[model samples]
Target: MRRSREGYEIYPVADAIGGISPTAHDNAMQRMIQAGAQPVNAISLVAELQRDWGRARADELRSILRWYFPKLQEIRAQN
Candidate 1:
């Protein structure tokens, strides 16, 4: 497995979104979609959206994070 600078193991984040149990994956997708439905015209809103998804899917959160990173990154870059 690849390792991050902080020494965390780095399996492909995308893998989490793909092969997870279907019920978990679908739940994550729905949360991600909801998080993404908000206006991203401001950084606070983007942060809130990210936090919302992270909290909503805390048990298996990375799937949503994987699905929405690009959009979230774009919003973060604006801050």
Candidate 2:
């Protein structure tokens, strides 16, 4: 929320963050949204950051995804 106040675009990974209780988590998520933070999951965050597959850093991004998200790589391979 401080970042959002500072005019930074905050993208909180919805699935990766949580509070002690379900109610707390929901409230925190709501607060973030109210503060102008965009909630995204891991996959959506990656896709947003790597919008251009044919960019110069495509290979580097692929390497990162392969290392951190092996399941995604596997799915891509299967397709």
Candidate 3:
């Protein structure tokens, strides 16, 4: 995955979900294949599936919050 200033771009996934037709996501997947951007597995980046937020994801979330929510500041040391 490539990282830009905005954040980790979900590219194809966003395109896949941002579909109008029933098979729009499938078409996005096809486009990803055509562009050689096939994914091997899905990993949780934050919240939800990750449950109580893993250590790595916690740091990432802290960074994100810091960038967007300046008032929050430090998110405390990892447990």
Candidate 4:
């Protein structure tokens, strides 16, 4: 059981896990690798990469955004 800042009772974010599964490593890596594949997803991915992973990763994220931004602009120009 937990209480919030105002002292109201609150449910936990999730129940405690007995133990982490070994495959969790591979699953997390796969999610990271595939996150840049979509437009909306790329936005968050760039933010996360910049804030947490620093300049090198941020530059890579910028390149990904630049690659996709032109396509989006073309789509906007069509309408």
Candidate ranking (TM-score, best to worst): 2, 4, 3, 1
Tens-digit lDDT track of model 2 for 1-79: 4465567888889878889998999999998898878889987888888899999989997887678777766868999
Which ten contiguous residues of candidate 4 have the minimum total lDDT? 10-19
Best by lDDT: 2
Looking at model 1, which ten-residue stretch has the lowest summed lDDT? 10-19
Instruction: Give candidate 1's error at residue 28 in angstroms.
Output: 0.3
| Predicted candidate 3 versus true structure: per-residue lDDT over 1-79, tens digit per residue | 5444566544443421546775886787777666555443323223344566556667776676457444323433322
lDDT of 1 by residue, 41-61 (tens): 333444455676547555465
User: Between prediction 2 and prediction 4, which has the larger TM-score?
Assistant: 2
In Å, residue 37's CA in model 3 sits off its true spot by 0.4
Clash numbers, per candidate: 0, 0, 0, 0
Those runs of model 1 whose alpha carbons end farther than 4 Å from true positions after fitting are 1-16, 37-79
Candidate 2 at residue 28, lDDT?
98
lDDT against true structure, model 2: 0.84
lDDT of 1 at 62: 59
Model 1 lDDT at residue 67:
65
| TM-score for each candidate, following the candidate numbering | 0.24, 0.57, 0.33, 0.34
Error of 3 at 73 (Å): 34
